[model samples]
Target: MDPAKLSNAIENVHRAGMPGLFAEVRDGDEVWRGAAGVADLSTGRPVTADMRHRVGSITKTFTAAAVLHLVDGGEIGLDAPVGRYLPELVPGERGDAITVRMLINHTSGLGEYLPYAYPSLRAFPDLAECRPQSLDDHRLTRFDSTELIEMGVTAPAAGAPGGTPGLYSNTNYLLLGQLLERVTGVAAEKYITQNVIERAGLQDTEFPDGPQINGPHSRAYEAFFGMIDPPRDYSVFDMSYAGPSASLISTVADLNRFFGLLLAGEIVHPSSLARMQRTVPIVSQEGKVIEYGLGLYPMEAAGGGIFWGHGGTTWGAGALSMIRGDGGRRMSVAMNLQRWNTLDASGRPQPHPIDDALAALYRVAMSG
Candidate 1:
């Protein structure tokens, strides 16, 4: 790999508006690591490759893998109704109709709970309402999992269970966390730690239960609902609101290791791995085409071929990890900024800087 070009790419990412960015790439037997910008804007702390950050929705990949481990062990069934495990939680006709596979693949039609629990710009689709002050009051609030699930369940379903045109809902994985607990007699975090994190030999990844990140890490920051305001430090906010759906904290190195093991069938059975890679096209609320599998996404590579992984974003952090389908290459990138996009005065959408950064990183990571 050309360090000069990679360094220039990092500089470009910094110029794009991220407070800081870090990336790790494994090309065959060699590994390349890079970072640019500040980890803490107030202190001007430089970001390092090993500094941890919230990996956000990438936690779903771990949750999915844990659930699949139960499936592989015959403790749970993919096609089985989630009602089989938590009949009371799901309950009645709706419960019986929704299957484990539907939840993992996001075909359960479950509505998201965040908007209902905390009305913020993230819940609103219009860019005009995405103001920084919208979420300022609830930054320190914590939510119970049961109440969060109830918020989603009481709302109308997104579509019929097992229906076509799947909608992405964090509620699906929230319930999956409940399902994992029901079957394993352990919390979702513990199960994933033993089965996925440890199995992947990841020392820097964890599902945190509190607002504090327990190790050396970059402070997370967000532009507050994508509004044009000074970025706020959100590194200490509670993640229980996200639970198993989006709260895993990790470094790029550990993320790349986890994806490498997952894609290589070391974390789950090959049959299960194959099922995890089976994908369906999803049209985002913004009308972009995304191919989603159980917990993985099939992103087009910079050069040619396909890579499988997931991207995650929280209030003030963002992460992306991907591996070649054939397991020849892998990369993980992270930034200490979220809601980085906003609308111009003309109502046109301004793209996030990470878009350009990832494009550059992908070119370098996927090169021969």
Candidate 2:
């Protein structure tokens, strides 16, 4: 397909009264990148390939790589109890039940909402106000892993150990982040920057400190309580609370390179990379049978190719990333608006418009 026509197809999505977006497709040595919508709609800034956006759970892929690096170094074992690294994590039911692999695979039977439950804690005027959380009340906002684990102990387990698979949970990755820090004797960000991001030659990506999107970024919009126009207040979507579960931010180009290098065995030892992609059964969100590998989600696309990547949703962001296993191609999309629960008048989540746009991009990438 001609790049111009492909670009027109992506831009026409917003023209169809859906939403404007920026996208990029890379093939072998050829790269076609373009942004066709208002990035910062508030100020009319146009989207660009370099514009940074929240990667949400896509950060897990990096964290998993770091853990596997330590494993390659013989510093940690996959089936070893997390208690071996962080003794504090061994409390109540989580004491002997959770292992390093279980945490990464979300088989640890931990609760899922300890991270997102903050938004439902107080009656908010809107999702935006709940996200950015005003400075005056900042002192009251803190999400500690210790407390999160304790909360999980009380909630009903998704299933018994090795019983059944569960969806993605921030608690799983948060524990993995702590375990990585413990074994490597380095901060998660530093280790990731040195081993993963820096090694990938991604000059445009950085781990952000909080919820706000800095530098050249997409126009972040919010769909709160199902209102389509915009969000009322976005004060509580603090990224700090997210920690390693979903704190990293990057551009589409950086994400593409990171995924490519990761799957190619450039980031970790060969055996470790093999272990990282090794998968087990996990429940599918769309009722499409799928498998959850170490940090990646392996799902069959409509085109009949198995793609490996992750989708992320934060306060006002919805993101999708995927790469074909054979190194044929890869695609990633990020939108500034998100609504996890609230639905449109026709009764659907607001982020679906952007999600569909991302799927379209994946289809084009696979067409090659």
Candidate 3:
């Protein structure tokens, strides 16, 4: 496929409804970068391919790699019980049954803590609900990791530990962060920065210290499923609520570099990479099916072969990165606006132009 096709696809995305978007695609030695749309709708400032953006849950891969570093050092066991290391946090039979592997793979059968943290999101039976009003309520509130983890632990178990079709939960990643702190004698973010981010040679990625972005960055615009008219900017909001699970800020280029190096066995050993690529049937927060691995997932391009990567989203930002199995091709994309779809009577997102445009863009980006 021609790079122009991908460029046009990005333009189509903005025209379809996205506020702004930037993307990078790689084919062996050939690379292409493009941006289309505004960085700030208020000022009409354009977005660039190199600007830093919140990569959201893509932070999970970094966290997983950091944990694997300890695995490579023979300091942590993948199947070890969480209770053995963090009894104070996970405690009792439930903790003993949930292994580190379960935590990373999200088969620990733990519940989500989002609804508990942001009460407006609670749907009663589970924490798998979302409410835009809650986003405004907690914009500046800093949440502690332990507090979040307990919400998941105390909630009724989603299923037995290591069960099939595991549930996706931020609580799992927070536990991983606690595990990292236990073993490394430092904050999880510190260990990951020193090990995974630094080792990947990613310069723009970091666990932000505060609500403000450090350098050049597009403002994050979220619609909360179109509940907020004209969308709202959450660019300066604190991310501590999601810390290890979804707080890392990065650029598209850095994301491509990280995934590329990860697949090439530069950050952790090849065996560790193999473990990260192992996928299982899992249910996402949106109740969608995803082939989730330790912190990675597979996206099959149209006849382009299997690509392994991850997609992440914050309140008003979204990003996805993918690389071929052989590491010869890749694509990393970021967008400023999120959840542009409005909900109808069924509580499902009504069809919108942006959704189709984003799908088309990915198809072109990953085309062979």
Q: Which numbered prediction scores highest in TM-score against the true structure?
A: 3
Residue-wise lDDT of candidate 1 within 83-160, one digit each (tens)?
Answer: 888787789998899999999998888877777777654534555654555456776778889888988887778889
Ordered by lDDT, highest first, the candidates read 3, 1, 2
Model 1 misplaced regions, further than 4 Å: 121-123, 130-134, 225-228, 285-287, 344-348, 352-354
lDDT scores of the candidates, listed in order: 0.84, 0.68, 0.90
Residues 221-268 of candidate 3 have per-residue lDDT tens digits of 988877788899999998999999999999998999998899999998
Question: Per-residue error at 111 for model 1, in Å?
Answer: 0.7
lDDT of 2 by residue, 1-368 (tens): 35876686677655543334566667678787766676655566666766788777888888888888888888888888777777776564565667788888877776664424454433232333344333224423666765665555455666665545665556777777778777778877888888888988998777776656567766556555454445422323466666677878888888888888888889888787677778877664333345787888776677688878887765566667787888657777766655524645544335545456555656766564
lDDT score, candidate 3, position 360: 89
Better of 2 and 3 by TM-score: 3
Candidate 1: how many backbone clashes?
0
Clashes per candidate, residues 3 or more apart or on different chains? 0, 17, 0
